[model samples]
Target: MGIGNWELGIGNWELGIGNFFLVFLVFLVFLVFPIPPFPHTPYRGSS
Candidate 1:
């Protein structure tokens, strides 16, 4: 089935914000408080 016209009217920013909150909720559920990981981490590989 195709998407409904009402849903399509919400547009990209609305979708993006919705997704952002959804992700935050999931993170809070799993981790309690979301502390983002450090950007720089050395890659570990077996020689």
Candidate 2:
């Protein structure tokens, strides 16, 4: 029982850290390659 509880605590800690790293990576990518504000159309001036 004691060993099982100790392992559960360790697993939870690792899971939390993994999720944090994933979120940080996504944020960095968005900051580096942001979407363009203007629309990319071939006929912007043509009507």
Q: Which predicted model would earn the best lDDT?
A: 2
Task: Note the residue pairs that clash in candidate 2.
Answer: none
Worst 10 residues of 1 by lDDT: 38-47
Give TM per candidate: 0.42, 0.45
- Cα lDDT tens digits, model 2, 1-47, are 33344455577877656665665675465467654763452334342
For candidate 1, the TM-score is 0.42
Best by TM-score: 2
1-47 per-residue lDDT for model 1 (tens digits): 01342254357767656666665675465455433563332221221
Q: Model 2, poorest ten-residue lDDT window?
A: 38-47
Model 1 Cα shift for residue 9 (angstroms)? 15
- Report clash pairs, candidate 1: none
